[model samples]
Target: MQDLELQAVESALTDLVDGERRWATTTLEQRRDLLTRMRELTGAHAQEWVDTAVQIKGLDPNSPLVGEEWMSGPYVMAASLGVLADTLDHLAKGRSPLADVKFHDVRDRVAVNVLPTSVYDELLLSGFSAEVWLRRGVSRAAAKAEAGLAQLDPSRTAGIGVVLGAGNIMSIAPLDVLYELIAHNRVVVLKLNPITDPLLPVFSKVLAPLIEVGAVRIVTGGAEVGGALVQHDLVNHVHMTGSARTHDAIVWGVGDEAVERKRAGDPKLTKPVTSELGGVSPTIVIPGRWSNADLKFQAQHVATQRLHNGGYNCVASQALIISSDWDQKDRFLAEVRNAIAAAPERAAYYPGSDDRVASALESYPNAERLGPGGGRLLVDDVRPDSAEPILSGEYFSPVYGVVEIPGTGASFTAAAARTANEVFAGTLGVNIIAAPASVKELGAAFDDLVEDLHYGTIAINAWTGVGYLTPTASWGAYPGHTIDDVQSGIGVVHNAWLMDGIERTVVRGPFRPAPRSVIRGELALSPKPPWFVNNKTAATTGKRLTEFAADPRASRLPGIFASALRG
Candidate 1:
């Protein structure tokens, strides 16, 4: 607790609160203008932002990973700002953001189609469909009533929001700030994670409009600075995107005493704290008739899920739930391993990633090592009765485990869903991959399985990471989790539709999307996504994609495609 750092944090918080008070009374028109300014600023600084992250991550400057950095950085923030501006613009015109809401009746609550709000969305993300399913007893009408009300009348909300930014994703902090500004109508003071301090200068320049107006403040420091800001009297609320362990430390005290404090229900801070935490996400594979092509396609899908962030993602498929009785199960598993081994290795850039991977392998010495490096170890052959560390812990590394169920078809899907809900720890995101024929056969039972799963986002034949990227979808753990027993932390973010009472987001994609479609596939998918570790030109394609997203031009398509083809 250095007095110098503490004093700086206090001064920042004091100024932030004053600005937020003024912001609380700001008109919808003013908010709209601010967000528009932010969007344009973000677009202008998009390239440098991506470059900074890629350089820090030790990635090749011109690699496809540039796309990864861009998409998860300025691209996401820019998209969020654009959506928020549109929502605010609607409010200024006295139109509800929910007036465009479309709903489909699932087994329990209705699934609200929030994205593809226009033809532009169809162009940007083709076949990548997203929907938010409200908790049971929450109706579409009720949800619409709550949508964008704060944006319409922000006089009711005023405060200084402290955002503990995530180091893993560059877009996370900016998006968190945007949520505070647009959704909650709070002025924000964002403290960048130590790992992301390098981006502070870029953020400062990009967010200059908001900072100049005192609506947003960007700071860089470690936990000491965060602690001071969190405890500051001027801070009205807190939002974090990190681990549950970090959350516990912030909510309670640190060290052994913190565990006891949590047990005793003693919290250090009682302010309204919302978070987007990590998870040991599971992918349930429903067994059915399958061809060699299906096996190859699904294998690539699961491999991409695990290797997306070098398996550093909270929504990475930590556990694979498959039916042992299926004839193609072994072949599918083999294909998954092959896909992982085929991809080029990414540097284990995140701190403690190597230690985490090593520890998991130590726990299961017999785990099969995949790929060139000793980083990715598959836990397919582990005894089910043993203490499986892979299922129990969220390994923030390129490690994956496979759990086998005895049944097939509907029974297999049901068992997998139950296991994912009860066995795996975190309730953040879960994946279900099933053949179309199998899904149709399950019928009502499939709906029931979706209703029963206790996860925030469930992707059918898709990764929940896609759901997290979808601005309309809510990204958080399933509801009904307590602070002491927070599995994947509390609350949600990136929800542009302003839909209320959201329990989960279900993003459905084809098992094998046609090439060149929004969803990636083997054939015609024009640009190889940078997230695929094997993609050679990730940086170049990623940059082009970011530029196109910021300002679309058909002329840029051919070059982007050519770069991807080279990869």
Candidate 2:
């Protein structure tokens, strides 16, 4: 490394040494106030943040799709700050963050309800709900006792940590930094991915409070800078949000030596590391009797699952699992194709997106190219037992393949879960879309089906991306992976509740939207969610929602609801 680069890294770490100690000894009230100030600044700069992301992604500033930037960039970060502040507030009051949360016993485990903790959630999110299922053997009392910063030793001086940021989403890098500071009690030097370095100034301004205190440092560069930061003696831990290949390169070195080190169970970096490496996530469709409207809406939902952000997301649905015996299988597939064809066009702005799309085309020469310019590709009837790369590899682009499993109901559900757990590459997340009536008919069998899945976050009739946006839900791969075979990296993030012993999060949303949901006996009032690619009022709703999250007042509800209803 150049002397200048090395000096810069050393200076960044040197500045954080004292800050880390100060942060460790800070009272809960002080931490809460810091977060509150951060939230206010986030609102102040929310527009600039979204605009920078939009310009970076080559998005039209006036288009509704710019709302994607608004929600994913500022809205998520603001919500996370507010949620963390609320958690600190509870801790300052000498209470568990989960004091008002409900817990239920599911077989031998306890599931803590992490959503709908406020009237705002009930009104804004309506039927959406999430629960963090504690690891087996954790009693409800143990969950409460283990919540929040109280678990940390007061005397131990926390050290500086390094966070290798993700490139795709604008909020990921900042959110990871917040988690390291608040959840793990460490001051962070966040190295931004080169692709997203353009937002450095915006992030710097929004995080000025922490930057002034030396509790946070944001840098930008390629791997060399990240390497120097991680290798610095002052850095005690590492957290990254990127691909498994990068994680392996960091932990086990590279080239022939890295392979040999893995075989011998030796790592180059001795410091503790945690990650959220993405895998080929699957969306399982349970067979059910359905009307045409049901099929079309779900088709759009599945399309959004794959095509959101042009399929550049870590949790985007890459594998479509369906029951072969369903009579509407062919019809639903046709509708999905139509939805993909009809969706708005956007640039595949992520680095190497074109090459990834080309590779998928080479792998499946007959893959249908839907939509204008033929950017969206779909491969149908992928054999379960075949040596297909799509089954075990993550194609981080606008490409998805369908796999059919035999049987229906419980048997089909079990086989689908087995295929996802055993066949898919990563355990980050999975989505199951079953009709409300079908789930009701399955009863305990459905709950057992969810319990059987091995992914960190499971969404029933909802997208796992929703789980990521929900600040209270724990986000990561299911525990038990070792460093040598780290599939989805390690540990969790966005867990504002701070409850320990989390195995996975289960999120559920209404099967249908608004009046249709009400007509079908479901009372959820949520319209087409603002995150949907097709939502016409998303930009307005997302901006309003971000402002509301920063200062949640009842006066803001009518505007948010009006904009959302128009979507």
lDDT of 2 by residue, 16-89 (tens): 98777776677778878888898998999999998888888888888898888878888889999998888888
Off by over 4 Å in 2: 1-3, 150-155
Q: At residue 403, give the lDDT of candidate 1.
A: 89
Per-residue CA lDDT of model 1 for 18-68, tens digit only, reads 787777767888878887887777778987888788877888776555667
lDDT of model 1 at position 46:
87
Number of clashing pairs, model 1? 9
Residue pairs with backbone overlap in model 2? none
Local distance difference test, each candidate: 0.79, 0.88
TM-score of each: 0.94, 0.98
Clashing pairs in 1: 63-538, 63-539, 64-537, 64-538, 64-539, 67-542, 515-524, 516-524, 516-525
